[model samples]
Target: MAKIEPGNGLKSAESRKSLRGTTESLALTDGEGNLFGSDSELNVYTSERQTDKYGFIGGAQQYSEQSAENIPPEVLRQREAKWLDMLNNWDKWMAKRHKKMKLRCQKGIPPSLRGRAWLYLSGGKVKREQHKGKFEELDSQAGDPKWVDVIERDLHRQFPFHEMFVARGGHGQQDLYRVLKAYTLHRPEEGYCQAQAPIAAVLLMHMPAEDAFWGLVQICEKYLPGYYSAGLEAIQLDGEILFTLLKRVSPLAHRHLKKHKLDPILYMTEWFMCAFSRTLPWVSVLRVWDMFLCEGVKIIFRVGLVLLKCMLGSQDKLKTCQGQYETMELLKTIDTRYMQEGFLVREILELPVSERDIEKEHLASVRRWKETRGELHCKSLPRMHGAKAIMAAEPPSRQDLRQNPTIIVESPLATKSNGEDKERKNTKEQKNGKKNSSPTPVAAYLEPSEPSPLLKDAALLGSNQSLSSAEYDTYL
Candidate 1:
């Protein structure tokens, strides 16, 4: 993947750049002087701040790739071998041998297989095929002016010190722009969210612009819907759910948070919203995302619980965090040990938070909030979560994916057209059957009800694209 000239890539693959009127700081002008894009995977560049392969700056005690590096080479080889086997038989593993897949995900998807594995786990490949050339079409079209400016300004800020983004308008940033702009075009209503950038950047690191774009769609729509939308109603609900689950995981941390009146959102907004791409160490971040893409949002809640437990779980640890401010400061400067892959993954597995627990908690939180703050700000309820819901809600057949569903937004407060009214009746009937079905105590909260897709597939979607069998087996 040769890096094209900074502005050249944008002009060819994305929109032309203009000097923005806003005075927002650009990461392109970092003190090391501008770096030209290169063909090398690791474009070594001198930096005033400490630079590692994963590109954590500012002398953070922990390096981004430290966790994977610490793994014994023999062990890595074994994991890679297992991943290769699993990748070759993905559908079989996903359906019949899910435990084997989960065990491997818990162990951590080998870095070499990360992107390809993610495409499969996230069902992004299916989405890309469904949409076809939609990305290219969106890329060529001029984006919404409002989103374009903000996206450009934020582009330089995303992993700016990293080799890929060091240039002013390099291929890295150019690709990032294409993904974000394509997203805005894909779902004009959800628009762009600031947290989506780094998440996109991380995906772009592993895959191409189109795959990355589809990966972002899965994260925003299937895995964590309503999270990146207007008002963040879904995250607010999850925040309450996290707090509720926290009580069982770490009572000390839970009690302290409640006593200090610390809203989970205050500390967790960045963590959960960014999917911990911004918080955890790079290797740990990748591990978390691997499991997250595999299992859905449960990985997120478990990660949050693990962090709170480590940071404030003990009386001794809470000595400094007696108040909200102190606890926040500690959260901001999390101990490196907590971010290590070995410790974090182990903790996540040990914690008993399940999809059922989350759904039950989600329903409770929604009802309680409806009474207090009124209904969700958005016109719809929160989506069903976890991997099962994602697969169920998203059609299994490529035929279904190709056929874009007619999306009719419904709200008690909003009026509906006659056609949309008919659609609403159909939707209600679906709800009455499976949507309102009673949940058993164990699997009850899967939010098994069909969720309105936050990012709808449109008529102007992509052209058919297929993943090569060999490429699917190995990212290399």
Candidate 2:
């Protein structure tokens, strides 16, 4: 018998070839050297391997293949040069060209720069730097048993068709588990929500574990606060807001949906909660996400409205759907063929819906929510287990402080109708006894009396300075 030393180098090409042949032969063996499986099994495994290599199995593959083909080289070069400039002079660019940044994002973030762009746009890098080593700490420690099982159950369900999460105990699944588990430990009050799984999965595809985790945090906290809380009041409120917007944008479709007893709750829940990851095609979903990070939650409402119009805008299509089930099926499985990413994004941008429109509706909807269910508080939730005392002692981050600075009320509430002007003038008179008022409407929902601090935080984070009604409106 040959003496085989473990880790000894194969001295020649012939030796390596022999080793390869031996390994291949062993793959066909059943304990001994005889083949154990049928040729069909071997062929099926080989075919799957080929598919994994070349076919678009999931979002990552689909995005890479399609994005490469769709983005012209000249456009890519122009966008890349612009992205480099923005990143190099981030502060200046952000301060001076913020509106221009929104337009660039709407055009579509180049694939090469998307990860870094997203980190900057969501302020994820700042948050990650602030919380260095925190993820590892939470990851090493055992998570609360309460959320462990729930997280585990939903782990495989997210992007299961994707190569990253296809296998049990795969690297992608493990990373997802760690991220979600760490979040539960980080914010035990919110716990784990099913919708967050897909959102995190999408982030993980673009960035590393730590960055992905913080991006998820920014999303839950700043972009759509109260959305994943115990009551899910944000989602419920947004559903009403969506219905209201639908009435304005497409009254016929809205009426058709309403007539069938279909509410935004039934169709728009997953759309808003997961940021359309579950509903839109992966390509369109990525496009939406690119804008969502830069522009905040307004993109979500825009995409939702566009989808509703696509599905139910046409009387012919609406007539084909008989009831709620049929309508939902149509909405859920929209024909991606017609709704190509570029077309859908264009439609969203062209839609006359403005930030002010969404903000006004959101405020009214939130008030309605509070009236029915009392005030919902984010601070009422418990802090992380061991970090509570430290969190109390530690001073707030500059970002956090900036987010909560003294509110500077803008004057002269902007009004479209005489009734609204009268209402605002009366409110202004009651508060300050003034006749002349600013044109921008006061987002009274943002007043301190509201229990959702996260909503206020969102308004602040979206702006460079103190939170004002105008900046708050930009959040949509």
Output the number of the TM-score-best candidate: 1
Q: What is the TM-score of each candidate against the true structure?
A: 0.73, 0.68
Write the residue-wise lDDT of candidate 1 on 1-476 in tens digits. Answer: 11223212112212111211132454333333553344231234434456565544432323655554477889988998787677565555666888778778877887667777787788787788777888889989999999898888788777765656656688889889999999999999988887888889988877778889999988888788887776666776888899899899889999998887777766777788789987777778888887888788999999999998898989899998777678778988899888888889889988898888988898898899899878676754345454445665664563422312212333222323444655666679798774534422211111111234343432323223333322333343
- Candidate 1: deviation at residue 106, Å? 1.1
| TM-score of candidate 1 relative to the true fold | 0.73
Give the per-residue lDDT digits (tens) of candidate 2, residues 132-191. 688888889899877887778667667655656656677888889999999998888778
**Given candidate 1, what's the lDDT at residue 414?**
30
User: How many angstroms is residue 97 displaced in model 1 relative to the true structure, after the best TM-score fit?
Assistant: 0.7
| TM-score, candidate number 2 | 0.68
lDDT at 441 for candidate 1? 24
Residue 265, candidate 2: Cα error in Å is: 0.7
